[model samples]
Target: MADIDLQIACEAPALPDAAFVERCCSAALDKIGRDGALAVRICEPDEIRQLNRDFRNKDKSTNVLSFPFELPEHIPDELKLELSELGDIVICAAVVADEARAQQKNLNAHWAHMLVHGCLHLCGYDHIDDNEAEQMEALEVQILADLNFANPYETL
Candidate 1:
């Protein structure tokens, strides 16, 4: 099994403890069969909104934003073994809480879903198309199920 180095920075009171976030991230990485280093930042609405607007051109707060690392193609083989930095996940505590409440879903489950979603993004999974969305969602559902959580897409 590969090792995952996860760093969690919480800027909101609603965010869970570092240990819980680390577990969620580790589970995601394990499901994807990857070992990497990543950072999860739990921030407030304003922080998320600014990031969304700047990076995605959306002037609103989102539940999460993923910044995947792209390595150069010409890197030496030996260098690749020492490089494990995957990317960063920025999650908005308030937005996640609100969405979970509005969707009538469990808070912890929803948070796990977000973490899994972000980690998948780091692994180059995207939902820009229907087919891609289906594939990604299936992986997410399977991962969540393995973690004893319900399918995130299923209505409550």
Candidate 2:
């Protein structure tokens, strides 16, 4: 299996350490059978809000945002083998922490869920429709279960 190269940038002091974030991302990649490079940025609410507004046209901060890298169809096989860039995932530390608290969930568990969710997005999973959401959510539950975490969708 190829290596999962993770580049993490944390702009918030309250966010988890780089090592923990990397482990979470690596687990997600391993579960999905994808080995590639991805960036995970832990930012302040303001930065995430700006990113959400600029890219998604939403003026509020979300827990996470995923930007998948699209490869050209005409790329040579040789070049494709050397290209490992998957995409970027931006997470709002404040929003994640707040949500975890409000939901009465463990912080680490919620963070792992966010990382897994973002990784799935990079791999072309989305929740735009009911069917898509069910599939994605099921995959997430399985992956999290493998990591010894409870289902995120289950109410406490």
Candidate 3:
């Protein structure tokens, strides 16, 4: 088994319950495997907007933003590990709620989708193009199904 470091921070008032957060983190780590460390931060809209602007150059608040670490081909001995440290996943609870409503999905399902989506991003999945989108969406469906959630791409 790999080392899993799951951190959940509620930097916003609209954050979900502790139990829900714990479940989300556990589900995410399970899907990502036990090897890597993941940090999930639940933030307010403004906080996410700032990060979106700073990192992605987008001024709007996004549901999730993944900052992946590009490791070199060869790392120092001290940096070598069985599992890698996946970068941070910042999620905006407010944005999530808005999206859930807009997409006509239950809160739990939407949150699950975002958590899985963020974890996939940490694992180097991207959807900048149509082909990538198809692959990523397929993976998302499979993972979410394994977690017993509905297909995230399914329309209501």
Candidate 4:
């Protein structure tokens, strides 16, 4: 099972519950054929904006950010056996909610998309170019579909 440490740092009452978050994240991890431990932090816009500015060099708040963990090469192999650390996924609750409404998407489906997107990032998936985007987006759509969610990229 994928180990997820969920941290809800926002005051939004509409945020998804722990079980739903785990199910979404786990589905992504399983689809990507990755097994590990990760953290999911749900925070407010201000916090996400600060993170985006500091790490991504963007001043705006994004819906999600993924920080993949890298173990030092010097660490002994035996030590690595115990913990399969993936990384952290920071999602802005306000941004997610707004985007769901703006996109006319089911809130739960949107949330699943964000979590799956982050999990893919944690597994070294990115869309820096057209080809890469195609690959990643295809995987995302398939994973979401497996979870019974509609294609997130569907036009409204």
lDDT, candidates in the order shown: 0.84, 0.84, 0.75, 0.94
For 1-156, candidate 3 gives per-residue lDDT tens digits of 223344445554445565654565556556656336666778778888999999888989899998876668787767766446777778888889898888899888888888778877887788999999999898788777877889988776
**Tens-digit lDDT track for model 1 on 31-144?**
888878887888778888999999999999999999998789999989988899898898888889999999999899999999889989998999999999999999999988
Local error of candidate 3 at 136, Å? Answer: 0.5
Better lDDT candidate (1, 4): 4
- List the RMSD of every prediction in angstroms: 2.1, 2.2, 3.1, 1.0
Compared with the true structure, model 3 gives a TM-score of 0.80
Candidate 4 matches the true fold with a TM-score of 0.96
Clash counts per candidate, in order, are 0, 0, 2, 0
Error of 2 at 84 (Å): 1.3
Candidate 4 segments whose C-alpha is farther than 4 A from its true place: none
Pairs that collide, model 1: none
**Which candidate number maximizes TM-score?**
4
Error of 4 at 74 (Å): 1.3
Q: TM-score: which is higher, 1 or 3?
A: 1
Enumerate residue pairs that collide in model 3.
2-34, 2-35
For model 1, the superposed segments whose C-alpha errors exceed 4 Å read: 1-11, 72-77
